[model samples]
Target: MSTFGQYFRVTTFGESHCKAVGCIVDGCPPGLELTEGDVQPQLTRRRPGQSNLTTPRNEKDQVVIQSGTEFGVTLGTPIGLFVANQDQRPHDYSETDFYPRPSHADWTYLQKYGVKASSGGGRSSARETIGRVAAGAIAEKYLRLVYGVEIVAFVSSVGCVEMPFIAQMRNDRALEPEFFQLLDSITRERVDADMVRCPDKDVADQMRDEILKNKEACDSVGGTVTCVIRRVPSGLGEPCFDKLEAKLAHAMLSIPATKGFEIGSGFAGTAMHGSVHNDPFVNSTVDPQGKPNLRTATNFSGGIQGGISNGEHVYFRVAFKPPATISQAQTTAQYNGQGGILAARGRHDPCVVPRAVPIVESMAALVVMDAVLAQNSRSKSASLLPAVSKSNPLMYGQPPSS
Candidate 1:
């Protein structure tokens, strides 16, 4: 499971307190321009100590491209990447020596591995995402160069303070027309204008206060990240399973602390009657080649239908739980299976949604890149075969006993 994607495969290594963390990205198209500079921005975004809102673990998170390219061009080989971990505080986790931190991986890690790291969450830590984010950046470069796909994610909420005009981000309520408009226009520049990363200034201020409030109390709060991938070519995803949305959910939930996920209309579509929920198709503005395109009048399907991309903006949300390593005293149990009070001590985000924005964008890029490569491979292979119309009997079912 350390490796992800059948086409653009990525295998990550190292641990939270390890000397370094990084990944080997295979299947990048040879001759595409790439280098450490191409990957470092995202790693910086995912790195700790960005602000008071995040952990004080000061990792420069500077990525070094160890191999897989010659003079900034990928060789289509396994690309080696790594970042040295500069900050270490094994003593901070001394509390974990006795009691397993509540709601953390400490106990389960021991249960699964028969042992666990002495400091930090080890492989389970968000630090592992360094590799993911790094690899994702490479995929993103290719996606943007060939497809002009733009992936953006922002903090949509923090605790009870949801971004204004996002409708509660609940599953039962469909988004307003204006929300879709916002989805089409929102940019990372706007989202990153503030440290909280909320697009709206007022909302970002509120979210900042919320995090600061919890930070001061040695408590934590959870929130949601909304991501939009625009200009995605249609016809990605598998039918039986591995649907685009399913793969998206798989990627999003893989991030540490992610608890929930929803796509496009998501849960809210359920409340509407079929008549109101369905997205009606229409003629598109057409591509530069003047080929007519099909599009939805309303995007309740979230730019995907039948588990495939529909040439609309693909958007979704991921909800994260409060950081489990809150320093507040909690009545929990010891690793010896006894009752006790565990006051966990560590540097963790009071709210993770801000820092999670790039992580979300990176994972989204990975999913899109995988789907693009899968569909491309299939399309190229199919192009060599004789064309068969839908009217052909074999197209309907297995041809008359083979």
Candidate 2:
């Protein structure tokens, strides 16, 4: 259950209060130059104590490379990474002994394992994502160097405040022009410049203040993160089962507190007629052989059509529920069906969207990376066969009869 991806496989380990938390990344191509420097910055961004909007848990989240590299180059073997749990405070969670803590993982984990971790949320904690972030950085490095892929995610909303796309989403599902431009030109540097990690400076400030307000009230709030992957090549997905958007949804929803997942025109496009919802093609690309390529007139498909990438910017949004471990008192049931008021004690984010930004981006990289490897395998194998001629009924290039 711990492992993910078919080709670019990764297995994560460790609990919230464990000695260390990390992952083993398998199947990375050899000779790719990698080091702690390539991975640490994202871990640092995912770390706690970043700002007033997050938990006060002062973890530096320092990462170390344990194996699978020789002189800072990946050897195409399993890469082991670990980050010390230096600032963990398990005692703070003692209140969970009496009650399961509503909306928290305490009750279900105990039911599932017949036992639970001694402290914190155990494997249920967001801390478990350190391994994901680490593995993703490696995948990102490969994608970046070889394919020029760029993934950028930002806090699109915090509680009621939303980025313009979400704010004005209508049944027609035609998002704003500015939203498209934002996807075309946004950068991580611009995203990180804001206090709340939202690229729009004005929205970031308001989101920050709102989170501080929730923090002061000992409550938690929910929000969403939007991610865009650019320069991903066409035909990178499995059909019928692992559609590109389906895999993206699975990966994004796997994060600790994710509540929902939607890709380009999601939900909002449902009300539109096919005439408005369909993406029309335009001849806008040229191959190295000087052949023209078909491009989408509108990206309503979100860079994917028929379960494959369409060589356009792939964009999606993930919604995170409020951090379940709030310090506020609440009436809830105990493990024995007894009822009582519980005031939980733990360090959790008032708003998770800012920190979830990197997690979203990393998971996107992993999905795209896995898809790349799968497609590459197929392409290589197909190259060995004779090309299909127009006379063949099974020709892949032939469109279906109307």
Candidate 3:
């Protein structure tokens, strides 16, 4: 689908190498503060040429708010956002015209549309995500302002260079309270501290070296990104198909090159018994508002149960495949049904997980923001109901007593 979300609909447009790329965001609440500055941080993080590990293409990816805001506040109308493509190198993609890159959308896109963009895989390019990041920025700002939600993502693994704790946590099928605390304290500043974007300095260095090795070999690598959403209120997401995790998976898998999505224990939970996987809830002290809070002794469920948020941290990991285009020579079939050697040429990232951090965070924000809006609409309707009382005949669809 070109558009995403029910309450907070976003329809992105343009493509890689196009004159511009952006989106139209609808259903944004009014009277909230918004500006280009609020959206630029994520775009800058997702932009190319940030480091030697990423693509050398230098795109400032500056966003312009064309409509839907006045005096720095949203007008609750459709928001028009745009970012011009300033670094397009269409000639570099001429090689792909005759033969499709292996494991790329070139073959499938040609089959689906009977036509394809002449350069840079068009919508298949990572550059297409610029619109997503921009729209997500607005969603994120609103989420943070209204619910104090914090979303952070980091490169958890690049090829075999995984975080030290990842294997252990998978084996144990448990997450420590300390880990939650650490996740709570994590900021984009920390995630962006190094080029690899892994919070652990040692692991990040190892990941960097791995990517450099792949780049040197004219190859590419794939990895996973772990994201945590904290301070999300309970009761988001519908019951069946539109469940929170389901919607999250939909949003995540929609991103280019994303191969898998897992929440909480994810695939690891299957190895353990229900006794180990089930989260045991315990009563907790009240919040500042004097409302009692319930917390689990263990978060094996990953802050979600039955596909819904439980007033705990909602976290997930997205698996990304290696960039399909590599300079390495590969023997593949041509459009004429003949065999030939193809060596992709064009600037590409050796490993995409580092840049994918912000994209993951941005998609998560859109999902959560959409859910929040849906819940708000439902809550508003429910709030108008009169209290159940025998004296009130209107409760039974009759006239009230005079």
User: Candidate 2 lDDT, tens digit per residue, 1-402?
Assistant: 889899999999999998889999998999999999999999988999998888888989888988899998888889999899998888988878878978888889999989998799899999999999999999999999999999999999999988777857753357878889999999999998975999987888888888989999999999999999999999899998999999999999999999999888888878677998898988866677444568888888899998999899999989999999888999988778989999888788898888988899899999999999999999999989987565654553445675
TM-score of decoy 2: 0.96
Tens-digit per-residue lDDT, 1-402, candidate 1: 799888999899988888999999999889999988899988877788989999887889999999999988999889999889889778999989999888889999999989999999999999899999999999999999999999999998899898755564364366776788888899888888898999878888898999999999999999999999999989999776899999999999999999999888777777778888888988756667444567888888888999999999999989999999998999988888889999887789888898999999999999999999999999999989987774566654446655
Error of 1 at 28 (Å): 0.8
Backbone clash numbers for all candidates listed: 2, 0, 0
User: Each candidate: what lDDT?
Assistant: 0.89, 0.90, 0.90
Best by TM-score: 2
Assess candidate 3 and give its lDDT: 0.90
Q: Per-residue lDDT for 258 in model 3?
A: 94
Q: Across residues 1-402, which tens digit of lDDT does each residue of candidate 3 receive? A: 689999999999997898999999999999989999999999999999998999999999999999999999999999999999999999998988899989999999999999999898799889889989999999999999989999999999999999865786777756666666767788889988898999999999899999999999999999999999999989898888899999999999999999999988788778888988788989877678445578887787777788778988888899999999998999999888899999888999988899999899999999999999999999899879974565566644457667
TM-score of 3: 0.94
Superior candidate under TM-score, 2 versus 3: 2
